[model samples]
Target: MDVAEYTPQELARLQLGFIIREQPQQNADHSGTHASSRKRELQRGQQKARQEMLDDLGVEA
Candidate 1:
C-alpha cells in the first residue's frame, strides 16, 4: 500500500516526528537570512502587497 493510504493516527505520528526532527534546524531570524537579504525580502513583500491592493481597487501602482 502507498504511504498516502496510512491511517490518520499514523499520519499524525509521522508529522509530529518530522517536526520534532526539523524544528531545531529551522531559522530563528526575526527577518530572514542576513540583514541585507532580509531588507530585500521585506521590500519585495511590501511591493507585492501594494500591487495586490491596487489591483483590487482597479488601479495601477
Candidate 2:
C-alpha cells in the first residue's frame, strides 16, 4: 500500500510504542505517540480502527 495515501491519523496511529526507536526510511522524523504511554494506547486504538477500515476494502494492515 502507498503510505502517502494514508491519513495523518493512520500514519500517526502506526507509530505507537516504538516512537523514537523507529526511524522513517525516507520521510522526516515524526513525533508520534509522545506525551504518555496512554497516548500510545490511544494510537493503537486508532491503528485498529484504520486496520478495520482497510480490511473492509480488502487490504490487510
Candidate 3:
C-alpha cells in the first residue's frame, strides 16, 4: 500500500489499470433503461480515455 515504494512508471501502470464503476444504487432509474444507456456511455468514455492515454504512452492496447 506504500505508493512511495513504487516508481513513477509503476504508479502510472497501477493508476491506468484501476477502474471506478458506478453502483446500481447510484442511478435512481431501476428500470434498466437509462442506467444501461449511461453505463454504455461511461464505458465508451473510459475506453476512449484509455486509448488516448495508451497512445500518449506509445503503448499498443
Give each model's whole-structure lDDT: 0.59, 0.60, 0.65
lDDT (tens digit, per residue) of candidate 2 on 16-55? 4355344343124544454445455556676677777798
* Sort by TM-score, top down from the best: 3, 1, 2
Count of steric clashes across candidates, in order: 0, 0, 0
lDDT of 1 at 5: 96
Cα lDDT tens digits for candidate 3, 10-53: 66555544432444556655747777786777667667767876
Q: Which has the higher TM-score value, candidate number 2 or candidate number 3? A: 3
Q: Whole-model lDDT, candidate 3?
A: 0.65
Write down the TM-score of every candidate.
0.44, 0.39, 0.55
The C-alpha RMSD of each candidate to the native structure, in angstroms, is: 12.4, 8.1, 5.0
Where model 3 places Cα greater than 4 Å from the true spot, the runs are 1-20, 27-29
